[model samples]
Target: MRIAMIAAMAKNRVIGRDNKMPWHLPEDLRHFKAMTLSKPIVMGRKTFESIGRPLPGRHNIVISRNSQLSIEGVTCVTTFDEAMTMAGDCDELVVIGGGQLYQQLLPKADVLYLTLIDLDVDGDTVFPEWDDGSWQLQNSVTATNDKGLQYSFNTLFKKC
Candidate 1:
């Protein structure tokens, strides 16, 4: 399975501040839905909680060490291994994150879909720094969201 990360980070790489996304861009959300619909999406417990409910039309897999806790409409897996196993022969796995998840999965990912927002905000959750030696930019398309927020949709492929 091909692992990819889909995120929108600020100029300073801030992903979230308090268990929530820092910005609301309708076009970006539309892009997210278009890319992730019907695919298996892997994310951390906090990211799942922040979303509040399982997104319709996709398999939501939440990675956590706690096996006892469970959320309806979503599969709760205790480890990355188990998550991978549950995903089976999925053509792609989208690592939709909450900091730690990004750090843990970025190394294994083959493609990255990053929405580069042009704002910097204070936040505890930040995207992992990309290593210039390991990944190379493939495509970048700049567009304005429905809210008129400017963002760039960038894709990166890992260097072999």
Candidate 2:
């Protein structure tokens, strides 16, 4: 199965603060939903909690070590490998994040779907840094929201 990651990060690579995204970009959210629907999504427990619920039309696999933790409409696992095993037979799985999960899975990803926000906001959480030389940019679409937040949707494929 193909493994991909989907995330929106600021110019400083900040992805979240206080367990929530620091920006309000509805267009980016819509794009994320459109791209991830009907696919299996693997994320850390914190990421799942930040979202507050299972995303519709997709298998929600949350990685956590808390064995007793259970939530309706979500599957909890102790490791990233377990999450992948649970995803079983899928054509593609999207690694939706909370920093550590992104870092851990970056090496295995075949593609990355990123929304590069123009603002450089302060945040405690960040996306993991990777060498740009390892991935080839496939496409990009620049857009501006009603609030004047500028961003670009970019797709990159890992070089062979």
Candidate 3:
């Protein structure tokens, strides 16, 4: 399986605030849905709760230490390794996250599909700092939505 990250971050690497996205970009949301459809997506418990339910047409694998917590339609695991094992045979393992979950699995990912939003706003959850030295940009495309939100879709690959 190919592990990958799919997230939207700001210039300051801000991902969320109080369990909600800091920005509103419909195009990016649609792009995210398009890319993740029919794939197995791994996410932290917080991220899963933020969305309020399991995303349809995909397997929802959530990471959390609370063994007693149960979410309908989601397979819950305690660690990143467990999540990996549960996603066996999946061609693509998409990491959908809040913050800490991204930090834990970013190193294991082979590719990153990042939506770089242009604005920076106050946020509590932030994406972990990655070692750019070990990765290279594969491709990018800049676009503006109907709401005038400027964003870039960037793909990065680990330097092999």
Candidate with the larger TM-score of 2 and 3: 2
Q: Estimate the TM-score of every prediction.
A: 0.95, 0.97, 0.96
Runs in model 3 deviating more than 4 A are none
lDDT of 3 by residue, 25-100 (tens): 8888898999899999998888998999999999999999898778889999998888889888889999999698
| Sort by TM-score, top down from the best | 2, 3, 1
Candidate 3 Cα RMSD after full superposition onto the native fold (Å): 1.0
Error of 3 at 75 (Å): 0.4
Q: Considering every candidate listed, which one attains the maximal TM-score?
A: 2
Q: TM-score winner between 1 and 3, please give it.
A: 3
| Candidate 1: residue 74 Cα off by (Å) | 1.0
lDDT of 1 by residue, 1-160 (tens): 8889999899999999899888887777888998899999989999998998999998999998898978998889988788888888889989899799999888889999999998888888999998878988999999876666778988998989
Candidate scoring better on lDDT of 1 and 2: 2
TM-score of predicted structure 3: 0.96
**What Cα-based lDDT does every candidate model obtain?**
0.89, 0.93, 0.90
Give every collision pair in model 2: none
Clashing pairs in 1: none
